[model samples]
Target chain A: MPRSVRVRLFATARLAVGRAVLPWPVPEHGLRARELVAALEQAYPRLAPTLRGSRFLRNDRYLRDLDETLRPGDEFAVHPPYGGG
Target chain B: MAVRLTRRPLTLAEAERRLRARPGGAVVVFAGRVRRDRRRGSSVVALEYEVDRVPALARLRALERAARRRFGASELVLWHRLGRVRVGEVAVVVGATCPHRVEAFDAARYLIDELKTTVPIWKEERGRPVRRPPRRRARPGVRSAGSGRAP
Candidate 1:
Protein backbone atom coordinates (compact mmCIF):
# COMPACT_ATOMS: atom_id res chain seq x y z
CA MET A 1 0.00 0.00 0.00
CA PRO A 2 1.26 3.50 -0.87
CA ARG A 3 1.96 5.75 2.14
CA SER A 4 -0.07 8.93 2.41
CA VAL A 5 0.74 12.25 4.10
CA ARG A 6 -1.72 14.96 5.01
CA VAL A 7 -0.96 18.27 3.34
CA ARG A 8 -2.55 21.25 5.01
CA LEU A 9 -2.80 24.75 3.55
CA PHE A 10 -3.40 28.05 5.30
CA ALA A 11 -4.29 31.58 4.34
CA THR A 12 -3.16 32.35 0.80
CA ALA A 13 -2.01 28.80 0.32
CA ARG A 14 -5.48 27.62 1.19
CA LEU A 15 -6.98 30.12 -1.22
CA ALA A 16 -4.75 29.02 -4.03
CA VAL A 17 -5.39 25.33 -3.54
CA GLY A 18 -9.12 25.86 -2.93
CA ARG A 19 -9.00 23.31 -0.11
CA ALA A 20 -7.66 23.23 3.43
CA VAL A 21 -6.32 19.70 3.38
CA LEU A 22 -5.09 17.19 0.82
CA PRO A 23 -3.99 13.61 1.12
CA TRP A 24 -0.77 13.18 -0.78
CA PRO A 25 0.65 9.84 -1.76
CA VAL A 26 4.31 9.25 -1.07
CA PRO A 27 6.86 6.45 -1.33
CA GLU A 28 7.16 3.82 1.36
CA HIS A 29 10.27 5.56 2.67
CA GLY A 30 8.50 8.91 2.51
CA LEU A 31 9.92 11.93 0.68
CA ARG A 32 11.73 15.17 1.40
CA ALA A 33 9.73 18.32 2.09
CA ARG A 34 11.18 19.91 -1.01
CA GLU A 35 10.00 17.06 -3.20
CA LEU A 36 6.54 17.15 -1.67
CA VAL A 37 6.22 20.88 -2.31
CA ALA A 38 7.46 20.54 -5.89
CA ALA A 39 4.97 17.77 -6.50
CA LEU A 40 2.19 19.91 -5.06
CA GLU A 41 3.07 22.82 -7.30
CA GLN A 42 3.11 20.52 -10.30
CA ALA A 43 -0.29 19.17 -9.32
CA TYR A 44 -1.81 22.55 -8.60
CA PRO A 45 -0.35 25.16 -10.94
CA ARG A 46 -2.26 27.97 -9.24
CA LEU A 47 -0.61 27.10 -5.91
CA ALA A 48 2.95 27.53 -7.17
CA PRO A 49 3.19 31.25 -6.53
CA THR A 50 1.71 30.98 -3.10
CA LEU A 51 4.05 28.12 -2.22
CA ARG A 52 7.01 30.22 -3.23
CA GLY A 53 6.15 32.75 -0.55
CA SER A 54 5.12 30.27 2.10
CA ARG A 55 6.70 28.49 5.04
CA PHE A 56 6.34 24.81 5.77
CA LEU A 57 5.41 23.07 9.00
CA ARG A 58 5.54 19.37 9.68
CA ASN A 59 3.19 18.14 12.35
CA ASP A 60 2.89 21.43 14.25
CA ARG A 61 6.62 22.12 14.04
CA TYR A 62 8.23 24.55 11.63
CA LEU A 63 10.26 22.86 8.91
CA ARG A 64 13.24 25.15 8.51
CA ASP A 65 14.94 22.71 6.15
CA LEU A 66 13.21 21.60 2.98
CA ASP A 67 15.41 18.51 3.12
CA GLU A 68 13.46 17.25 6.10
CA THR A 69 11.67 14.01 5.35
CA LEU A 70 7.91 13.70 5.68
CA ARG A 71 6.65 10.28 6.73
CA PRO A 72 3.30 8.65 6.17
CA GLY A 73 0.32 10.02 8.13
CA ASP A 74 2.34 13.15 8.97
CA GLU A 75 0.72 16.53 8.64
CA PHE A 76 2.46 19.10 6.49
CA ALA A 77 1.19 22.64 6.68
CA VAL A 78 1.77 25.42 4.17
CA HIS A 79 1.76 28.85 5.78
CA PRO A 80 1.69 32.06 3.83
CA PRO A 81 2.96 35.34 5.24
CA TYR A 82 1.09 36.19 8.41
CA GLY A 83 -1.07 39.31 8.62
CA GLY A 84 -2.20 39.15 12.21
CA GLY A 85 -2.13 42.18 14.53
CA MET B 1 -5.11 32.29 30.10
CA ALA B 2 -2.45 34.69 28.97
CA VAL B 3 -2.60 33.56 25.36
CA ARG B 4 -5.97 33.39 23.60
CA LEU B 5 -7.17 32.92 20.02
CA THR B 6 -10.89 33.32 20.36
CA ARG B 7 -13.80 34.00 18.04
CA ARG B 8 -15.29 36.45 20.52
CA PRO B 9 -14.69 40.18 20.52
CA LEU B 10 -11.59 41.60 22.17
CA THR B 11 -11.60 44.48 24.64
CA LEU B 12 -8.90 46.61 26.26
CA ALA B 13 -10.89 46.74 29.48
CA GLU B 14 -10.72 42.99 29.77
CA ALA B 15 -7.04 43.00 29.00
CA GLU B 16 -6.46 45.71 31.61
CA ARG B 17 -8.40 43.71 34.14
CA ARG B 18 -6.26 40.66 33.49
CA LEU B 19 -2.96 42.50 33.67
CA ARG B 20 -3.90 44.70 36.60
CA ALA B 21 -4.39 41.69 38.80
CA ARG B 22 -0.64 41.15 38.78
CA PRO B 23 1.59 42.91 41.35
CA GLY B 24 3.57 44.85 38.78
CA GLY B 25 4.10 48.58 39.09
CA ALA B 26 3.32 49.33 35.45
CA VAL B 27 0.75 47.95 33.08
CA VAL B 28 0.27 48.79 29.42
CA VAL B 29 -2.52 47.74 27.08
CA PHE B 30 -2.88 48.11 23.36
CA ALA B 31 -5.97 47.32 21.29
CA GLY B 32 -6.14 47.07 17.51
CA ARG B 33 -9.39 47.83 15.74
CA VAL B 34 -10.65 47.24 12.22
CA ARG B 35 -10.91 50.38 10.15
CA ARG B 36 -13.31 51.25 7.33
CA ASP B 37 -10.69 51.49 4.65
CA ARG B 38 -11.40 52.16 1.02
CA ARG B 39 -10.24 49.55 -1.44
CA ARG B 40 -10.20 50.72 -5.01
CA GLY B 41 -13.66 52.35 -5.12
CA SER B 42 -15.40 50.19 -2.53
CA SER B 43 -15.54 50.84 1.20
CA VAL B 44 -14.44 48.17 3.63
CA VAL B 45 -17.37 46.97 5.70
CA ALA B 46 -15.78 44.15 7.71
CA LEU B 47 -12.75 41.93 8.04
CA GLU B 48 -12.91 38.17 8.05
CA TYR B 49 -10.13 36.80 10.18
CA GLU B 50 -8.94 33.23 9.95
CA VAL B 51 -6.35 31.23 11.89
CA ASP B 52 -4.61 27.91 11.78
CA ARG B 53 -5.68 27.23 15.31
CA VAL B 54 -3.13 24.70 16.55
CA PRO B 55 -0.03 26.50 15.32
CA ALA B 56 -1.44 29.92 16.12
CA LEU B 57 -2.14 28.96 19.72
CA ALA B 58 1.29 27.45 20.03
CA ARG B 59 2.92 30.58 18.66
CA LEU B 60 0.86 32.74 21.02
CA ARG B 61 1.97 30.72 24.02
CA ALA B 62 5.56 30.93 22.87
CA LEU B 63 5.23 34.70 22.53
CA GLU B 64 3.73 34.95 25.99
CA ARG B 65 6.67 33.05 27.46
CA ALA B 66 9.19 35.15 25.58
CA ALA B 67 7.58 38.41 26.72
CA ARG B 68 7.65 37.35 30.33
CA ARG B 69 11.25 36.17 30.19
CA ARG B 70 12.64 39.08 28.21
CA PHE B 71 10.77 41.89 29.92
CA GLY B 72 10.31 40.49 33.40
CA ALA B 73 6.59 40.81 32.94
CA SER B 74 4.39 39.39 35.68
CA GLU B 75 1.21 39.29 33.70
CA LEU B 76 0.20 39.32 30.04
CA VAL B 77 -2.84 39.20 27.83
CA LEU B 78 -2.62 38.39 24.16
CA TRP B 79 -6.03 38.03 22.64
CA HIS B 80 -7.09 38.00 18.99
CA ARG B 81 -10.59 37.82 17.60
CA LEU B 82 -11.49 35.52 14.76
CA GLY B 83 -14.39 35.58 12.21
CA ARG B 84 -16.04 38.71 10.85
CA VAL B 85 -15.18 41.88 12.68
CA ARG B 86 -16.94 45.08 11.67
CA VAL B 87 -15.23 48.41 11.25
CA GLY B 88 -14.13 49.99 14.56
CA GLU B 89 -14.42 46.66 16.36
CA VAL B 90 -11.53 45.52 18.49
CA ALA B 91 -9.67 42.77 16.67
CA VAL B 92 -6.80 42.21 19.02
CA VAL B 93 -5.50 43.22 22.44
CA VAL B 94 -1.95 42.84 23.73
CA GLY B 95 -0.94 43.99 27.16
CA ALA B 96 1.69 43.34 29.77
CA THR B 97 2.43 44.18 33.39
CA CYS B 98 6.01 44.63 34.45
CA PRO B 99 8.14 46.12 37.19
CA HIS B 100 8.54 49.39 35.27
CA ARG B 101 6.77 51.40 32.62
CA VAL B 102 9.47 50.93 30.01
CA GLU B 103 9.35 47.17 30.28
CA ALA B 104 5.57 47.21 30.16
CA PHE B 105 5.50 49.31 27.02
CA ASP B 106 8.26 47.39 25.34
CA ALA B 107 6.66 44.06 26.09
CA ALA B 108 3.28 45.19 24.79
CA ARG B 109 4.85 46.46 21.58
CA TYR B 110 6.90 43.35 21.09
CA LEU B 111 3.93 41.11 21.68
CA ILE B 112 1.82 42.81 19.04
CA ASP B 113 4.64 43.12 16.53
CA GLU B 114 5.70 39.52 16.83
CA LEU B 115 2.13 38.30 16.73
CA LYS B 116 1.58 40.13 13.46
CA THR B 117 4.62 38.64 11.79
CA THR B 118 4.73 35.18 13.33
CA VAL B 119 1.22 33.96 14.11
CA PRO B 120 -0.71 32.03 11.48
CA ILE B 121 -3.63 34.43 11.27
CA TRP B 122 -4.91 36.32 8.27
CA LYS B 123 -7.62 38.87 7.47
CA GLU B 124 -9.50 39.43 4.25
CA GLU B 125 -11.40 42.66 3.89
CA ARG B 126 -15.05 42.61 2.88
CA GLY B 127 -16.18 45.65 0.93
CA ARG B 128 -19.54 47.27 0.29
CA PRO B 129 -20.50 49.15 -2.82
CA VAL B 130 -21.48 52.82 -2.63
CA ARG B 131 -25.25 53.21 -2.83
CA ARG B 132 -27.16 55.73 -4.91
CA PRO B 133 -30.89 56.27 -4.87
CA PRO B 134 -32.79 55.31 -7.99
CA ARG B 135 -33.90 58.14 -10.26
CA ARG B 136 -37.65 58.79 -10.55
CA ARG B 137 -39.26 57.54 -13.77
CA ALA B 138 -41.55 59.82 -15.81
CA ARG B 139 -45.12 58.61 -16.28
CA PRO B 140 -46.75 58.64 -19.71
CA GLY B 141 -49.71 61.02 -20.15
CA VAL B 142 -49.48 62.10 -16.54
CA ARG B 143 -49.36 65.75 -15.54
CA SER B 144 -46.66 66.92 -13.13
CA ALA B 145 -48.13 68.06 -9.80
CA GLY B 146 -45.72 70.96 -9.30
CA SER B 147 -45.64 72.14 -12.94
CA GLY B 148 -46.89 75.73 -13.53
CA ARG B 149 -48.47 74.64 -16.88
CA ALA B 150 -51.06 71.90 -16.31
CA PRO B 151 -51.62 69.07 -18.84
Candidate 2:
Protein backbone atom coordinates (compact mmCIF):
# COMPACT_ATOMS: atom_id res chain seq x y z
CA MET A 1 0.00 0.00 0.00
CA PRO A 2 1.20 3.53 -0.80
CA ARG A 3 1.83 5.97 2.00
CA SER A 4 -0.94 8.52 2.28
CA VAL A 5 0.20 12.14 2.40
CA ARG A 6 -1.66 15.37 2.85
CA VAL A 7 -1.35 18.01 0.16
CA ARG A 8 -2.13 21.54 1.18
CA LEU A 9 -2.90 24.24 -1.35
CA PHE A 10 -2.81 27.98 -0.82
CA ALA A 11 -3.68 31.15 -2.74
CA THR A 12 -3.07 30.64 -6.43
CA ALA A 13 -2.23 27.02 -5.86
CA ARG A 14 -5.56 26.43 -4.18
CA LEU A 15 -7.37 28.28 -6.93
CA ALA A 16 -5.74 26.19 -9.59
CA VAL A 17 -6.01 22.85 -7.86
CA GLY A 18 -9.63 23.48 -6.77
CA ARG A 19 -9.18 22.42 -3.15
CA ALA A 20 -7.56 23.47 0.09
CA VAL A 21 -6.25 20.00 0.93
CA LEU A 22 -5.99 16.64 -0.73
CA PRO A 23 -4.95 13.16 0.31
CA TRP A 24 -2.35 11.61 -1.95
CA PRO A 25 -1.67 7.87 -2.05
CA VAL A 26 1.95 7.21 -2.80
CA PRO A 27 3.76 3.96 -3.54
CA GLU A 28 5.15 1.92 -0.64
CA HIS A 29 8.69 2.99 -1.52
CA GLY A 30 7.40 6.54 -1.14
CA LEU A 31 6.81 9.11 -3.80
CA ARG A 32 9.79 11.18 -4.98
CA ALA A 33 9.39 14.88 -5.53
CA ARG A 34 9.19 14.52 -9.31
CA GLU A 35 6.81 11.60 -9.06
CA LEU A 36 4.56 13.69 -6.85
CA VAL A 37 4.43 16.35 -9.50
CA ALA A 38 3.38 13.82 -12.08
CA ALA A 39 0.74 12.48 -9.72
CA LEU A 40 -0.56 15.94 -9.02
CA GLU A 41 -0.72 16.61 -12.73
CA GLN A 42 -2.76 13.48 -13.19
CA ALA A 43 -5.11 14.27 -10.30
CA TYR A 44 -5.94 17.83 -11.26
CA PRO A 45 -6.25 18.20 -14.99
CA ARG A 46 -7.03 21.91 -14.88
CA LEU A 47 -3.88 22.52 -12.87
CA ALA A 48 -1.68 20.32 -15.00
CA PRO A 49 -1.07 22.93 -17.65
CA THR A 50 -0.22 25.54 -15.05
CA LEU A 51 2.08 23.16 -13.21
CA ARG A 52 4.33 22.95 -16.20
CA GLY A 53 7.46 24.96 -15.30
CA SER A 54 6.08 25.84 -11.86
CA ARG A 55 7.95 25.37 -8.59
CA PHE A 56 7.30 22.99 -5.69
CA LEU A 57 7.81 23.33 -1.96
CA ARG A 58 7.90 20.56 0.61
CA ASN A 59 7.04 22.14 3.92
CA ASP A 60 8.70 25.59 3.77
CA ARG A 61 11.79 24.71 1.78
CA TYR A 62 11.88 24.81 -2.01
CA LEU A 63 12.45 21.50 -3.72
CA ARG A 64 14.72 21.79 -6.77
CA ASP A 65 14.63 18.11 -7.67
CA LEU A 66 12.24 15.12 -7.30
CA ASP A 67 14.62 12.58 -5.81
CA GLU A 68 13.48 13.37 -2.27
CA THR A 69 11.14 10.73 -0.83
CA LEU A 70 7.70 11.67 0.40
CA ARG A 71 7.29 11.24 4.11
CA PRO A 72 4.00 10.36 5.78
CA GLY A 73 2.30 13.37 7.36
CA ASP A 74 4.38 15.60 5.11
CA GLU A 75 2.55 18.60 3.69
CA PHE A 76 3.36 19.54 0.09
CA ALA A 77 2.43 22.70 -1.74
CA VAL A 78 2.59 23.71 -5.37
CA HIS A 79 3.53 27.35 -5.80
CA PRO A 80 2.99 29.27 -8.95
CA PRO A 81 5.20 32.31 -9.50
CA TYR A 82 4.15 35.07 -7.12
CA GLY A 83 2.59 37.73 -9.34
CA GLY A 84 2.09 40.38 -6.66
CA GLY A 85 4.40 43.38 -6.55
CA MET B 1 2.81 45.01 17.15
CA ALA B 2 0.04 43.03 15.47
CA VAL B 3 0.00 41.48 12.04
CA ARG B 4 -3.55 40.80 10.84
CA LEU B 5 -4.89 39.28 7.64
CA THR B 6 -8.61 39.50 7.10
CA ARG B 7 -11.14 39.63 4.30
CA ARG B 8 -13.28 42.31 5.94
CA PRO B 9 -12.75 46.02 5.34
CA LEU B 10 -10.01 47.58 7.46
CA THR B 11 -10.61 50.41 9.91
CA LEU B 12 -8.02 53.19 9.74
CA ALA B 13 -8.97 54.49 13.16
CA GLU B 14 -8.36 51.13 14.80
CA ALA B 15 -4.95 50.81 13.25
CA GLU B 16 -3.94 54.35 14.22
CA ARG B 17 -5.27 54.07 17.73
CA ARG B 18 -3.44 50.83 18.33
CA LEU B 19 -0.16 52.23 17.11
CA ARG B 20 -0.53 55.44 19.12
CA ALA B 21 -1.07 53.48 22.32
CA ARG B 22 2.42 52.06 22.00
CA PRO B 23 4.17 55.27 23.21
CA GLY B 24 5.64 56.11 19.84
CA GLY B 25 6.35 59.64 18.76
CA ALA B 26 5.37 58.99 15.16
CA VAL B 27 3.07 56.64 13.31
CA VAL B 28 2.95 56.18 9.55
CA VAL B 29 0.48 54.07 7.65
CA PHE B 30 -0.07 52.94 4.07
CA ALA B 31 -3.35 51.52 2.71
CA GLY B 32 -3.80 49.93 -0.72
CA ARG B 33 -7.26 50.33 -2.21
CA VAL B 34 -9.00 48.62 -5.07
CA ARG B 35 -9.35 50.83 -8.11
CA ARG B 36 -11.43 50.90 -11.30
CA ASP B 37 -8.84 49.40 -13.58
CA ARG B 38 -7.33 45.95 -13.98
CA ARG B 39 -4.32 44.66 -15.90
CA ARG B 40 -6.34 42.83 -18.48
CA GLY B 41 -7.73 46.17 -19.62
CA SER B 42 -10.90 45.23 -17.75
CA SER B 43 -13.03 48.14 -16.62
CA VAL B 44 -12.75 46.41 -13.25
CA VAL B 45 -16.35 46.26 -12.27
CA ALA B 46 -15.10 44.55 -9.13
CA LEU B 47 -12.20 42.54 -7.78
CA GLU B 48 -11.70 39.40 -5.71
CA TYR B 49 -8.46 38.95 -3.81
CA GLU B 50 -7.24 35.58 -2.60
CA VAL B 51 -4.45 34.71 -0.15
CA ASP B 52 -2.91 31.48 1.05
CA ARG B 53 -2.60 32.09 4.79
CA VAL B 54 0.22 29.66 5.55
CA PRO B 55 2.79 31.14 3.22
CA ALA B 56 1.26 34.59 3.38
CA LEU B 57 1.77 34.79 7.12
CA ALA B 58 5.31 33.57 6.83
CA ARG B 59 6.09 36.24 4.26
CA LEU B 60 4.47 38.92 6.42
CA ARG B 61 6.56 37.92 9.39
CA ALA B 62 9.71 38.20 7.32
CA LEU B 63 8.60 41.64 6.15
CA GLU B 64 8.05 42.75 9.73
CA ARG B 65 11.63 41.76 10.55
CA ALA B 66 12.94 43.62 7.55
CA ALA B 67 10.94 46.72 8.42
CA ARG B 68 12.21 46.78 11.98
CA ARG B 69 15.80 46.35 10.88
CA ARG B 70 15.78 48.77 7.94
CA PHE B 71 13.67 51.56 9.38
CA GLY B 72 14.43 51.14 13.06
CA ALA B 73 10.79 51.31 13.93
CA SER B 74 9.61 50.56 17.43
CA GLU B 75 6.58 48.62 16.29
CA LEU B 76 4.86 47.60 13.07
CA VAL B 77 1.43 46.27 12.25
CA LEU B 78 0.62 44.79 8.88
CA TRP B 79 -2.93 43.85 7.92
CA HIS B 80 -4.05 42.60 4.53
CA ARG B 81 -7.49 41.83 3.13
CA LEU B 82 -8.21 38.67 1.22
CA GLY B 83 -11.46 38.11 -0.69
CA ARG B 84 -13.64 39.96 -3.15
CA VAL B 85 -13.22 43.71 -2.73
CA ARG B 86 -15.43 46.21 -4.44
CA VAL B 87 -14.05 49.23 -6.19
CA GLY B 88 -12.68 51.79 -3.71
CA GLU B 89 -12.41 49.20 -0.92
CA VAL B 90 -9.36 48.97 1.29
CA ALA B 91 -7.18 46.00 0.46
CA VAL B 92 -4.18 46.34 2.72
CA VAL B 93 -2.88 48.50 5.56
CA VAL B 94 0.63 48.65 7.05
CA GLY B 95 1.32 50.85 10.05
CA ALA B 96 4.71 51.63 11.56
CA THR B 97 5.43 53.46 14.78
CA CYS B 98 8.75 54.86 15.95
CA PRO B 99 10.38 57.53 18.08
CA HIS B 100 10.87 59.80 15.12
CA ARG B 101 9.00 60.76 11.98
CA VAL B 102 11.77 59.55 9.70
CA GLU B 103 11.65 55.97 10.91
CA ALA B 104 7.89 55.89 10.82
CA PHE B 105 7.65 57.16 7.28
CA ASP B 106 10.46 55.02 5.92
CA ALA B 107 9.23 51.84 7.49
CA ALA B 108 5.70 52.36 6.24
CA ARG B 109 6.80 52.96 2.66
CA TYR B 110 9.31 50.14 2.62
CA LEU B 111 6.79 47.64 3.96
CA ILE B 112 4.25 48.37 1.25
CA ASP B 113 6.82 48.43 -1.53
CA GLU B 114 8.41 45.16 -0.53
CA LEU B 115 5.02 43.47 -0.09
CA LYS B 116 3.99 44.30 -3.62
CA THR B 117 6.90 42.30 -4.99
CA THR B 118 7.12 39.51 -2.45
CA VAL B 119 3.67 38.35 -1.34
CA PRO B 120 1.83 35.43 -2.90
CA ILE B 121 -1.62 36.72 -3.79
CA TRP B 122 -3.99 36.60 -6.72
CA LYS B 123 -6.57 38.98 -8.19
CA GLU B 124 -9.48 38.28 -10.50
CA GLU B 125 -11.43 41.06 -12.17
CA ARG B 126 -15.14 40.51 -12.45
CA GLY B 127 -18.42 41.78 -14.05
CA ARG B 128 -17.24 43.62 -17.15
CA PRO B 129 -14.32 44.69 -19.27
CA VAL B 130 -12.17 41.64 -19.22
CA ARG B 131 -8.49 42.50 -18.91
CA ARG B 132 -5.56 40.42 -20.02
CA PRO B 133 -2.35 39.84 -18.19
CA PRO B 134 0.47 42.20 -19.14
CA ARG B 135 3.10 41.06 -21.55
CA ARG B 136 6.23 40.05 -19.69
CA ARG B 137 8.24 42.32 -21.99
CA ALA B 138 6.27 45.40 -21.09
CA ARG B 139 8.44 48.23 -19.85
CA PRO B 140 7.78 50.09 -16.64
CA GLY B 141 7.18 46.79 -14.82
CA VAL B 142 3.64 46.29 -13.63
CA ARG B 143 2.87 45.35 -10.06
CA SER B 144 0.83 42.23 -9.45
CA ALA B 145 -2.78 43.31 -9.02
CA GLY B 146 -4.01 41.10 -6.21
CA SER B 147 -7.16 38.92 -6.32
CA GLY B 148 -10.56 40.38 -5.68
CA ARG B 149 -11.44 37.93 -2.92
CA ALA B 150 -12.24 39.36 0.51
CA PRO B 151 -11.52 37.59 3.76
Give fnat, all candidates: 0.88, 0.50
TM-score of chain A of 2: 0.81
Deviation in Å, model 1, residue A1 alpha carbon: 8.9
DockQ, all candidates in order: 0.71, 0.40
CAPRI-style docking class of model 2 based on DockQ: acceptable
Residue ranges of candidate 2 with Cα displaced over 4 Å: A10-21, A41-49, A52-55, A60-66, A83-85, B38-41, B129-151
Cα lDDT of candidate 2 equals 0.75
Local distance difference test, per candidate?
Answer: 0.90, 0.75
How do the predictions measure up, each by TM-score?
Answer: 0.88, 0.73
lDDT string for model 2 (B14-33, tens) is 88888887777899987777
How do the residues A1-85 of candidate 2 rate in per-residue lDDT, one tens digit apiece? 3367788765556778778889888666778888888888887887776677466678766676878888877777776665432
Residue-wise lDDT of candidate 1 within B1-151, one digit each (tens)? 8988888887787888989998999999999999987657789988899998999999999999999999999999999999999999999999999999999999999999999999999998898886658856669878656756656
